[model samples]
Target: LDPASGRWIEDKLPIYDFETLDDFERLKIFEKPLLAALSRKSFIGDVLGKPANERLYGSLAAAAIAVYKGAHIIRTHDVPETSDVVKLSGALRSRTSVVKEGRYEVSVLEVKTPQDAGIAMRNIGATKTGSEVMQEKSIHLVLKIKNLTTTEALIIKQEMLARGGDAALARDAVSHETETTDVLVMGTLLQFGRLARKLDGQARSLPLIAEMIRECISNRTNLEYRYLR
Candidate 1:
């Protein structure tokens, strides 16, 4: 009878606690993610046996699976970067959380051109701040809009500033859209991945971030906007 049983079930599901695991037990559970991937027929290639390569792919596959299966936490030593990546990806429809299963989606409306997208995002107050020119759009806004609403963003900023430490305002934002399903206020596209990996990995403030974002916009081609409002 553990007090945290409820949380354990929700975050680490399928099983709660175990004293020990026999070889068979270990293999069975370990195969779940591989089987999960096999079920999708989404990937096919060389399955190597070397520990280094195999383990690397396994970790990535598991991480992908965890995201696919609605995992709430991930273990990593690079929390800042990882969390930054997570933050950006979750920017899409982040205004709300705790959605029904299979309800995640993003709306993308392709403007007539990249310039059109830039104008639209800037109208909403998004400042271009990225690593390179990922867009010709003057204001390529990448905002996390799912885990929180615009109102929540304001509240969070206020609370954090009031509490001390600038943790609320994002230096950069990204969206976590696996595909198009549940949403509004979008154009017509979806993206997912460790987005921070695309940046220079140096910025950590909002003011300088605006400059970084402009650099980012200057580095891309099909540059568009992830509007905040």
Candidate 2:
């Protein structure tokens, strides 16, 4: 043991093949130095691009390491969820992002149930009144629904036009047209939230929201949204 660095350095060990996690665990326990070589960096995660809540386990491990390493700052979306553990360990600290908020208009175009979506938008507004900003844009909605019959699809189209949302249909000549909705929409961010809130009730709708929003940004269209999935 060297007193300068306060550690023992092991020189030899076989790298484990990751055919099985159990073998990796055994190798770490029996062969690799478990605790002696550890520091704050021990808990660094390899979780690039994972959605926020999915990183909870890694976040917990990371917080533990933070406490171990005397960390003063951690930026994450699941703040309230992680704060409890950090508090119990006496590592809680206060911080908030300080930046000027930007303004944008959102158009809410196609939603399964528009009324319910409105409720969710209201709830979000109430929850983040001061720190967040939102604007609603008036617009048209066009949809190309796949599963609907001719008559039922027409009814939905009529409803959208009556409600000021433009609704389109799948092209008749194209082979792949029947599989997806062809919607033309224009709206602001708040309207998009209203539409999203309408669809937010179902578990599978989250990806729809993410995809639509992603398209909206990537395409840079006043067209607002295009929901394929």
Candidate number achieving the greatest lDDT relative to the actual structure: 2
lDDT of 1 at 12: 43
Tens digit of per-residue lDDT, candidate 2, span 1-229: 1011111234311111111111212222122232211122212222234544356666565554443333334444466866675675444432323344467445332322233334445555544443234223322233233454444344444543444454456665133435434344434444444544544443443436435644554443322222111
Model 2, C-alpha of 150: deviation from truth (Å): 11
lDDT of 2: 0.38
Evaluated at residue 123, the lDDT of candidate 1 is 53
**C-alpha root-mean-square deviation, each candidate:** 21.3, 18.9
What's the CA error at residue 211 for candidate 2, in Å?
4.9
Task: Compute the lDDT of residue 13 as modeled in candidate 1.
Answer: 27
Could you estimate the TM-score for every candidate?
A: 0.18, 0.23
Q: Write the per-residue lDDT of candidate 1 for residues 1-229, one digit (tens) a residue.
A: 1112112233542122111110112222222321121211112122233433234443444334433333344454344544554444334312322345476754443343344555455555567652123333323234333334333334334433343322233333213222212111111111111122222243333334334434444443321322111
lDDT of 1 at 19: 10
